[model samples]
Target chain A: MKYRHLVITDPAKLIFGTAPYPVKTRRGLHIGGGQVYSELNFTLPVMSINDQTLPEVYAHYRQITEGALERALQLNSKGVILEFETLLEMTKSPATGVEIVKIMNDICESFYQKHGLASEIRLTPNDLREFERPALQRTSRLLEPMFQLFEQGMLAGGDLLSIESTGGKEVSDEALMMCDIKAVLFSLAVLGVRDMQFLWEKIAALARQHGKIPAGDSACGFANTAMVLAEKKYIPTVFAALVRVISVVRSIVAMEQGAVGPDKDCAYEGPYLKAITGIPISMEGKTAACAHLSPVGNISSACADLWSNESVQNIKLLSGMAPVAYMEQLEYDVRLMNTALKKGAAYSRTLQQLLVESDVYTDAQALVLDPSNVIRISSALIQGDSYVANARNGALEFIEILEETLASGRMTLPEMELSYIPVLREELQSIPDSESDFIEMMLPLLDPSKFIPSEYGL
Target chain B: MNYILSKLLEAVEYGKVDQGSPYPPNLKGMDGAHELTQKALDAGIMPQEILETALIPAMGNVGRKFSENKIFVPQMLMSARAMGASMAHLKPFFASGKIKARGTFVIGTVKGDLHDIGKNLVAMMVEGAGWTIVDLGVDADAESFLEALSNNPGAVVGLSALLTTTMINMGEIVEKIKENAPGTVILVGGAPVSTDFCRKIGADFYSPDPRGAVEFLKQLAS
Candidate 1:
């Protein structure tokens, strides 16, 4: 909302590890404007949690943290981000996630003070909305625990706050599978946008109160679901491509509300988010194979401020534990980019182009992620005055890029995927220009019971 | 084929729920599966024929198209809704013992995982294939599956998990189910659940798409 259109209009200027608005974290870790940092996500091995297991769980987290940081130091790392994504079990046990945050922060403090290794922890609580039947996302008491954990985590020294929020995912799940563009728009642009605004408002307020960075939200539940489905070949890649584009507006609402740069890693829509909003983003790519598979493995890091390996468990590997091994992998990836940055701007741009070239032609899901294409789509997005209009414009722009990309022989797509372009184009173009008109047309098509319009404040 | 029966099948295949549903714009302003289904019955078509010849076959084609990537989840859901619309008229006959459904399928998202879109899709596709679905909803543990199985014996249990975090629960759940019902056939699926993981967990089957689950159940039924 600060700026309505594309901020970084020049694709060459939109490289990773830097942004127009950089977020300076506590303990002297300046994100977004420096060399790319490593954000290592580590989870637990298969184990039940209770009072008896709490000690083991605490020991596991300590082992992963010390182990990874020791390896980071061995590589002469600039800094590190340990994303303490709390499990549902942790949240159910009061202050367990918070205590882990305290443990991590103390270790980080020791690392910074003793070894001069700057680091911070991003606390992402489990979104428990899906635990409820029908998931009363807007007004469920079930959701308050998540915010409580966030507040406690920040108080206990969590630096950056983010959530893989699922506000509009109930309807979006169906829309994505059916390849229903209009429903996807309604879910993301309307309901998801409003939910981000509402949820981020609270998060932003909390961040402001605690003097912590309110890192933005991710449409992982929506766009990532589409991406995974596409990767599995259950849905058209074109559909996933469009979902990625449409998701940007919803994620940007966090910035519009108050959250700032360095959006979460799993939001593959981060490049476009960075292009439009000029916020540094944390992106995961090929190394994220430990967590999940994706076609955006290379291109995702093209504009990333923090390069991540998604999440790996605390199991042992030949080299070391999974988290420590992935940390070494991530440090090397960012080291290459930082070396490129150090060489010169011309060399950095070349590296960025190489990253784009490697993945762009391979998958339609990766095509829209090219920085130039991101700027184009962001330009088309700002042409619309409303969220609905912007979403439609963005989706149409994705198809336009695909059509142009295919026509120019820059890429080759399957005939099945190629055949969907015109149909998707027509469907997107058929949407009304105005928000109210679009909503009117969509309401009768969507089941009234699936989504509560009142929750979206429609 | 009867004239009304043909219209009903076309309506169901195209996802026409009623004259009011504004989908598949080509079929606008026409009676959908809801009205045509009742019409076929009133025209003296047997309810079993409508269920078998029209609803079951149309849904089978829908599932096949889905498996072939010719269609997606929305179209299949529409076909399911269309089949649901048609099935409403045949429910009474099914209750009166005039018709019999294929066996039951009990499904749920594994514990600590709250994703249901995948599970729901499989349930809908399986139910569309004319099976009774006992949907345990989300966050279902082994006890819930056992309770549902106790209520519906010979049921095929399908466990779904959207995260690698919760997918491990499938192993525990599968073991618990096998401990009680040694002969139970279990199916596992989700974003992270693969055939290898399914095999490692000792589950009977794993499919990436809902249509594959439908086909597997069809083969099981056969």
Candidate 2:
């Protein structure tokens, strides 16, 4: 059967926001860490298997993609939804895209033949160059066969086929408006190929006009107008292009208070339905966040949180998904903050106060405030805060607690049996003030036999 | 004497900026590369000896550690900082011909890409390896690379691209450099670059990490 409906959810908002879920995959390829092809909107390692034409290389690619698909299928009870961004990046180069499609087709055909099952594939094109004729031509040609295959697959499975475009470049006001209109038409046309659902995410007119606004008050006025328009449109996926936290807070508040338009009761139905329907939902915040946190979660918590959530839950749903020992890290910061609060340490006090004051604590407030919660909240805070600047102080406070925990035997080697000790040790040693002390503490914790001599790397 | 040089090397390797900087724990409050280089200078140690014997070897160790994954970006950055501190004292000597740099190497990220971590790493490693680096920061196009080459003829060129989209720009850059400055060796690297891609783009070299680029430049200089 073919999956229906396409829902877009923000992965970052889900994880870091009051609503958190378990994720399975701890790591994957990040965007812009290596040789990146910007036009394609993805990053790849300079020395990837794609560079080689050997059969073994092709096999490796097949194996990896198959593994990814298998995992996604097993983990997601609803149907597999593959991210097009990375795949798009890998296949954007004309030759590579052709090869990848050929390989995917061959795989699907083989699977279909073996199981007497129908194979339906959806292609989402997000990066369309502005006025770049060659790119447009290549993209169109590449999409044609895929669309045909999707139609055939849908017919075989009693399903429907669909295609969606993120719309091309934001050119002139006129051009952007035309692109939006064209996107709706194109989506409808694709839907017409089969009995499929068509969903169009439009860029607000105010956003288009905001691009023209000057650097100051003009921009603010444009932003306010964009919010009003977005709310009016009931745009499910709205990106507040505000720079400061105050602005984000204001926008969110505006959204909540009906300043933009009538406030709708927010529910988890969109994600829940998308998960059940087997249709892919694309959200701007989630994809944008993934791109921002490409290699690591150093600068963007909003993005990193979403990636962490999706990776965790999706991986858990997939078969043979390896358990991420690093999940315990989130607890580190929480525990440390607790310890500091108990000790009434100055550093801890500031962090604890921030946690108390910030909206971030709303969900975890009961658990964090509990006198005897078993979960290690310190590491989680540390890991989460590692990417966002606002979270750094909390992370630092957690580190302080970790240092004290190590110093006091009360932390006990028994509790260190978890996978996070080594990582925590490394992080501790990386600190300037307590490096030697942490190293000394860790050696004994690692091996009780040589607590004295081995503590100094003897 | 060897012990002092080793200590200086250690200082640089661990990022001991000076006596005052309390980083890397083991050498807290100890005299760092800055102090040691000055002391070595005052003691009548030859400037060349300081560079070749003390600073270069220290940076080499840092580069090796980086390649082996024993250290990461932040650590490598610290070592580079330490090396820079030491190099500051020796730069004027090199300028006056009392000392000599290996050679000049021009580097820049390809057009349409603004990311800089990879480019910065390559630039630092190449500079630390004793070559003069002409860094044309992020979003640099072919003309900038060509202009730098014109000023420093025969200098090796390196192009960095951290985006897949920009890799295509690298191909155009390689072609442009070849057309304008024939015989100039060009190296391309970044997360998405491979040896095969280097060949496809007509670049002379490709390395996954900064150390490999530094080693390649060393070979070219030799």
Candidate 3:
């Protein structure tokens, strides 16, 4: 509202009340833009979710999304939308897939219905056989339970330190905010998720409001879809309408925020998969919003500068996964992450306790012991080349906070993480942070690591 | 100093395709790799000299830049485009025996992986370095590699994969290629691949960047 072309690279920065000042990366009517990015990794251990907490979990998911979209509407006058990986998650049971698809459809249909945009939106049928067959075929029955566990872990951080009870849990306005793994999983599923067509279809009508879905700007996971498509030798027939739901929501905010800067950006990096399948269209007025393009081969290493929405889309249409050496970059980045973690652990007990578990010191230790969520944050930021402010890596944040808390002697690392809950509660659109499941989600970003110095060796 | 060759190298590094191509705006309307190579040849410069002095070194510079994160895919591909345009002029010489290749490199994305950007980059770089390239294309299984090796004896085979799942095929392909021809020097590169992976799979070498692959070929040929 205060500026033209407001673009956010790291959502965490915003959540931390450090939203970056708008910068013009390209020329266009960039009303509003935010990098609503997420990442997922199979290397992290997964956790199970009980049937009892499904309703609360679903509600929390809805609150985070609906809240974000509503704010997006305030910016662009058109609310963004969201979609879950129900279809891919349901691959273990085709019948269950059908049931979950119906639920997802209801979720989208209701959102559009409430917004009076339902008539414009169109959802698709179960179409796993087309682009996702290879992924589905690679599915092992043994891994089905693990996927469910991953979903649970993603939806609610691993039976986290703070989330003791889902039933009738009193969420006060003062509690810290947690992250939902669903968003991370939503993008991560591109590697080989089935029935994405159903999700993409729901996003189609939503695209009419914004025009083309800026794929790369959505997240690092979008580029991974190109690998999936190339592997399946599949190309989507309909390209313009589909976008990552997170982007659909964030762009609405970018639009409504209504930055009036010269050459305000509205175009973003098109998903590489779209280059093969989407009909070429001029991004002139069809430019929707800016997004983040990220690394796919391996998550956790800084690879390339974050592509602006302008160059990202133009580049994708120009080429389709032509110079494929990202995997090499991933390998190179992991070594760096290990080095950082090893170093940060040496200088601080805050980091050390994260790795060690003490019944007395619960919160930070919980995040340290559970590294999956931490990796998710790492995965989200590893692919960024550079940003207006900085990229979000939980470990790096931990390291930074660890250094600050030690120097300032003001708040402990766990207290610093807990401190943000109130801010998230204030900033969130729909639900209060007290009601949300964010402990495990925020832990990796908020906690100090427990790395023992390499010199100490113990 | 070969003034024309240096211009050619600069053209290849900056991705000046030809006089009319509108990319790399700073170098617009200037003679590109396409024009410079032809001019170098017209000046009686040997095709081998152009490959060595201009094309190879230029691609090497681009490859190193890519490793250092100084450039990205679009820029690298633009460089490749420039290299490809210049290399086109030398094809006839290679075919007619006027320019002898340093070696032959057979490359593909390996079985189970259809991604080819990395493979193509390596292919262009090796080709720019004066090696004959037999591209097996994506989804290449063991048989295609073995067949390529049989057709071009002493040809170095390159394997590429972009996914961890797809990368598994490299080991299988290497084992089969070694079984078929024990002395075949196989090179592997890709996102999930590492030098450790190459050694474990019994491949001769693995490079994280395209320039490294070119370096290996240069060493092998010597």
Candidate 4:
């Protein structure tokens, strides 16, 4: 009777198109539906060209610079994010990344100078792989000039003065190296270098000591440095006191902000609590809330061309030619659970098994013990990607399960599958709606003449 | 290249489909690839010459330009369409063995990924280079790849996936094809696919562009 629209949802009254469940239960993790996860900033120039020469890449930046700067200004962002990794891959050295920082700084400086824009613009560096070299020695090579610019009070030209390496990797090696990196970051932060990011690692352990909700800081250094800026406190005192904030912020965000529950999600990745706590996140971490004068910049990159192509939905096929600026938002926790549950079934493990068996548990092992808590906490941290990755793996595993079970008459999906899919499609359709400029971007490519559904007569 | 084949080359490069096709409007009303290819054949031009000297070289230029970003997807697609128009006339000759095709090539986008643009481009470019292409379309799984290889013994198989999620699916398809058709040459590609991925999966060949695959096939035939 309800087959007319195919996708059915009564959002206010129904959970799963009328299957009743209490509000925002942890059990939501056991089912599947469309999820509104963070649509990340898949900034332009990702996967646009393969096997590119250095000149080609630089030419690509020049071609897109006007458009990119215009979009940044429209968004009121301090500056833009660029894919320096491409250049680094071309050079294959940490010192090269630093060299690229200077090149990028030149680009930003020229953009600001030419535009005659009064507000300073910066470029955010992302996907930093250089954990070791380009040390204080190398940093000073670039920094000394910046310090001179600051001394001359002519540092207003937006340049990538900051560095970001998402903590806890090869960057997490030693007290000496970590201290060295932090020491350089601190010096640059002082001399009007822009805010750097991915400096927060193992922040959960630190959060517990401060009686904060134990959350790992994927962007740890944000809250830490924000506190320093807030207290006008000695930088080391705040850095020493820094702990994970996203989970705490998420908890407060979920409880205090009613919009972030079962039905509603934050319209943008607003640091609502960061405003209250006076902790800066993201670009704020870089700027120290503009507390530090004209800090260095960050020029990060995006991948997959997934969100980068502005016309992706209409294009039927996306290439890097017409790139769109993108940003991400944290989906309501309930939605993450439901998505992990339903979509994850086709992957390596069920949501329950994912919690019990897979490394999803150990990913947050020291962080938390509860499965639901792990989903909430780990999903906000670096561990979330692996969960989605697990589902992708589950997609392959589900194929095997379907094959073996269908062959042996041992397994069939729960009967709810029929009613469930339309909702899944409906939820997926919302992605385009939210990204209205490229409304069709998230939809799978379709050619009725050629594309046949995997489930035909179900 | 001879005059007729040279015209064919220009037609493919500029995406002049046929005299009737309105694309590449400057070339409209002129003899297009469809007409020029036919004219070459009627003038006693060998099919091998049309492919080697004209079609292959034209597609090679297109591929090089693509890598250089002188052309993008829409342009590449246009060129592929023109190439297809010409290949339509040659397919019959290859079927009858009047014109020798080096070998058969079975190609498809892997299961779970529906993107066909890249796959289609590769297929068209490869076909232009004189191989008989059996395109299985998108969402082709390991079983389908194996079946395609079985029907065309000694043919090369190409698997494509655009999503990182589905790129893993390529590994399964490659492994299955290798296991079932142990001797079949496998070429893997797509946006995310790298030569490193090719080596990791034990696939025999990987190309970022369709021209690379075509050149690899040509080398094998030689």
Best by TM-score: 1
lDDT of 2 at A407: 64
TM-score of 2: 0.46
* RMSD, one per candidate, in order: 3.1, 19.8, 22.0, 24.7
Please provide, for model 4 over A1-458, each residue's C-alpha lDDT reduced to its tens digit, 9 standing for 90 to 100: 00112111211111121112112211121111222122112122322222444455445444444444454445443223332222223223333234434554465556567753222222223222232232232232433332332222112222212222222222122211112223222122211111121122122222223322211122222323333222321122112211222212222322221211111111011122222221112222111211231111111000000011111110111423332322211122223334443564343123333323332211111112222322232223221122122212212222233334335653233332222223323332332212212213312322223212121110
> Of 1 and 2, which scores higher on TM-score?
1
lDDT of 1 at B113: 85
How do the residues A163-267 of candidate 1 rate in per-residue lDDT, one tens digit apiece? 988878878887887888888988898888888888899999999998999998889989888988888677888889999999988998998988886899998
**Model 1: colliding residue pairs:** A178-B74
Estimate the TM-score for candidate 1: 0.91
Candidates 1 and 4, the one with greater lDDT: 1
On the 0 to 100 scale, the lDDT of residue B118 in model 4 is 61
Which whole-number lDDT from 0 to 100 does residue A458 have in model 4?
A: 6
Whole-model lDDT per candidate: 0.86, 0.41, 0.41, 0.41
DockQ of 2: 0.12
Among these predicted structures, which one has the highest lDDT?
1
TM-score of 3: 0.42
Residues A1-22 of candidate 2 have per-residue lDDT tens digits of: 1212211233222111112222
